[model samples]
Target: MMLQFEGVVATGSAALDSGIGHTALKTLNDVTYLYSVTGPGGGIAVWKLVEGALPQLQDTEYFSGTITFQVGGIGMPATLAGDDQLVLDVRTATGLIGYDLNPDGTVGPLQETGTLTGGGDISALVQFGDILTIAHESTGQIATYTVNGDGTLSLSASIAGQADSMQVLQAGADHFVIAADATTGTISTYNVDQNTGALTVVDNSDALATLGIASPTAVEVVQAYGQSWVVVAGAGSNSLSVMELAGDGRLIPTDHVLDSLHTRFETVQDLAVIESDGHVFVVAGGGDDGVSLFTLTPGGQLVHQDSFADTIHSGLQNVETLSVAHVGDELQILVGAQQDEGLTQLSVSIADLGIVRDGFGTVTGTAQNDMLSGSILETTLMGGAGDDILNAGIGATTMHGGAGADIFVMQYGSDPTTINGFQAGTDRLDLFDYPLLRTPGQLMFIATEQGAQIKFLDEVIVINSSTGGPLTSAEVFGAGFGGPDHIPVDFGDFGGLEPGSSDGVQGTVTVASEAANPGLSDAEIRFTPDGGGTISVRADDEGRFDLGLPSGTFEGELEIIKTYSTASYEITALDALQVLRMSVGLDPTWGPATPENLIAADITRDGMVNALDALAILQIAVGLPTAHEAEWVFLDDDTDLSGITENNVSYETGVDVTVVDNVISTDMTSILLGNLEPV
Candidate 1:
């Protein structure tokens, strides 16, 4: 269907609408649309999708300011390539604003045409095959511009002619036409060369076909009634001029010359064609302020169809240019208001007219890791609608939900959950580490519910305690899985053969006592502290201590001790110190004595049988480490006593008394009885 245009319409914040230049509007092959507009700010307002609901267009990313090339004023429209692109020329005090649009409809840099007055403006947009045509109203000439691959434009050909407004329709590979209506309230048509944009005036052209078309400002037409024609909108009488084309391409009068469509308060500036099907279409718009439709029969006559003009608010707004775009099966009308920054869009869906979509495909829903109860691998998850639960491992990842009732899942750490949020499929949230599970004060406690029981799951080690959910203490839980128990130290040899901590060696010692009491529990005894050599004594069924060390020579006195503690009980009493000493040949450097070396009672060196030697022994033998005592001795055999008178001992009644004299022991060492020696 051909579009019925209402040109560039805008709304919302007035400040945001400031620099939007939306003048280069046109239709191609009559479908797939193209137009350009400036940003309210640095970018333009785009209407896009959220979660597949009805779309809302609001002002968004923007850039350039002000429309300088005069595209919307008494101007014609043009599109380059196919629907590949379109161009809008701006009119400014400095120079005209010229913009090249991408096929996808984005505004690029504006070019200045180098018009010396710095005041030239562009009117009309026309496309003939690969070339795009623009008419400079100031120069009254036609310029055919070429479309480059990178979406830039350069002039290919120029032809001088006073252009009021130009329109081009396909004639041949390189042929086109331009109609320049005059400021003197007249209309003229020219057959154009597409290869050069050169003008050839047609012979049958009537200079002022409609006498009252005072401001023959804009003209539009599409083929009907076996020929191409023109609908010229005028300012003075508000008349519509119907111009017919001769075989050579000149504007001739139709059966009816001038038809008064509407008495206007302003010059009419918009026009359009609406197709009902592929073949039939209605010519409409460009009048005092209403939309009227017309259709042609097989005969060469123009027939009027119904008008939606009554639906329009009479004087509330004025529309200058109109373009229609089909979004799917729906038709949207865009009207550009010249006098005021006014825009109105009216849309209607053809499917709403009793059409059904059977094979119409679908609008897919997103599926992601958005569940509430279980663990999920982020890499395996797809984004979709609905709440979800996720169990995560150690990593950084994204979770998204596309639509209603959506849930996002993330496993926090070994112990907990970290983040939860809701948004569209593209929304992203970051999960930080769950650090609180590491605090020191959190302890594990076992509580048994009334009828509840506590036990290590794997161990079957039962606990008889009260239970609850998992009583505070803020404990993290795991499925019961326990490890091994460790062996402990025993008595006696628990701390084995370690040397005396003081002198670092086995010393002169005395044995106090010895006992072999192994510790309560039989521990696997082992050497103590690795570097020190070892001592080992096994612990009995009842833990006890049994330890001793051999004595050395220097007084060798030491206390051998043992401490015993009952299993799970503390040691309370101890009889631990036992001392032992050795006195036989204790010194390796000294010898035994008879007389000369005897430090005891044998004190006389004369080898005597007399009391004088006994008296010397008595004096010193009574005192030891120092022999200072006088005449008081611990006796040897009590040989001399002052008070004794035959009471201590008695010999026979008849006693023989003999006297012996001692010799020097080396000179004559024999002692003899007289009778026994002579025999």
Candidate 2:
């Protein structure tokens, strides 16, 4: 029993949204997709396109609580891989990263993994053999994460940043993922290491080989003969290039087919290519919305056989994302009609997927300029050469303005609370029109991960501030620094408190004060140095601050009072002996002061210029002393530039600094042993 898209009638549900990232998978086992058309008034809708023909959507109830990133950069959804296993991306929950998603769709806590500066927009995803690689549109970070046996994932490596699209193809044992960068307008190649999931840059400046590939949007690979071929689509140049992939994972451009040459379509973004019955079919749809078929030589060269031209648009509806399949008996082409805000499926018996009707004209909207907000694709609503209103994404969205000095509006949040989260009613509205959307209360900033846009909208008015305009707020804190000194304000949960060796993961850590210090009654938890330090603390009823530093290593302190009478006050630290050997558990302090304080001669882990100070120096060089221990006691002498070898010591070629005395030298070393600062 084969089920296909017979027709699309209406939508289903228009309220709280839920989406499984990337493509929606519909199996043969009766599960259909329904669109829920939405309006401004928060009107509810439930228009079933398939009616009772499809199984109802499963209730995503248990997945409620803190809204954390649900999917990651590896083999996710479990449906994407084996039923017993799933791979997820490194994330930051609380303060930790490396958040894996379970088959039950639950977050697998936090763990530190590899470093990935950018994690947004994983449109280009694939496992180039061993490494699960994804190309990000936000930062062009070509990151690869390895899937662990426990279904967890670790960030392996990421180099290429802000790539438009990616596709993995194999030739012999070597594998490569073709990456088309949106920013550079070039086709880059990556060689993936199967063992470590590492990505090595193959070639990014291969644009010289390509003919008209200006800013590619889609890339697909087909195996013809023993060679693999890459089909690159350009939304900018309105062209498609056919490149050859050698077994070594290098791209060799053989030829290209420009849309201008066919005089059919102007731009191409979404497309699919398949090899069927000894013929290679390339369906180039979306943007101009058309398809093209071709024949390939055994040597990986594309010879265009036939192509469908122009837009067979259903009225003014625009098809943004397109997916084609040569499955079962018929060729299915599913088009995501973006502007139409619906999904249109057309099953062509190898003919309808071709050209149906031409004469698809364009809409020359009002002679006066209109407005547009949110994000824009490669080829999108051209403002018809007028002074149009454009509200590009928070980042610098590519706007042609088409010879018109268009007025663009971009906004983001400046206040700190905005960095955390928006308050109630905080509408993250993407203003369709510039002037109308530029009503002030919006803040715009650069995206830390992806290079796209970021606009922080405070539609909720949730911040605990009393002043400021529409994008301005006092703070998320109540009375104290981060919050009130009395009330227990929420700052969310702690992330991965222990990530052993994962690169990208930075976990959460909370410090609880011991039995209560006697000299710390009026203390206040403040990230000290106040100006920009990361450490903070708040005492118990008796006065003890609990500092929760997300990052593993940090060095900063809080205060005992709301306002310190004296800037410098001695606070008791764990005994230097006990603090140093934190590796071995310390015995309980029965009363006070013990011989542990007088362990041995203070071993300064820094430079001691005096020749007579060799014994103390030997202990430090061999990794002696604790962070809270030891000090140098010496006066006025040139710190020798000496190096100790397996044989002896030779002071030569030293760092540029003047060590007046052992005390100064020791202090300098302590500063070098910097405390963990909040990231």
In candidate 2, stretches whose alpha carbon ends up further than 4 angstroms from where it belongs are 1-10, 13-123, 128-130, 136-140, 204-208, 260-265, 289-316, 350-679
- The stretch of ten residues in a row with the least summed lDDT in candidate 2 is 662-671
* Candidate 1: segments with Cα more than 4 A from true spot: 1-10, 15-86, 92-104, 108-120, 145-159, 171-174, 207-212, 224-226, 255-267, 276-287, 298-300, 310-316, 325-331, 338-341, 346-679
Measured by TM-score, how close is model 2 to the native structure? 0.40
Tens-digit lDDT track of model 1 for 196-267? 545566654332432345766666665643446566655554444555554456454332222333222244
Question: TM-scores across all candidates?
Answer: 0.40, 0.40
Cα TM-score of candidate 1:
0.40
Which whole-number lDDT from 0 to 100 does residue 98 have in model 2? 27
lDDT of 2 by residue, 1-679 (tens): 0123434322443221221112222232332222221222221112122332322333221222232333332222222123221223323322113233333333344343334445433445665433567665555477777766543456788785556467788876877878776567777788887787677777535334425567787788988644688888777867666777766665656445455343223466566777644445666654554444443444233334334433343311333454555544455544444444334454444321211110101212233333433221111223434444333322123332333333333222111111112221221222222212322334453322211133434311122111222322221111211100111111110211111111110111122243344233333333332122223333433433334222122222222222211112111222233223321333324332122121111223233222223333333334454333222111112333133321232222111222121111111111111111111
Name the best candidate (by lDDT): 2
Residue 173 CA error for candidate 1 (Å)?
7.7
Clashes of 2: 61
Q: In candidate 2, residue 397 scores what lDDT?
A: 32
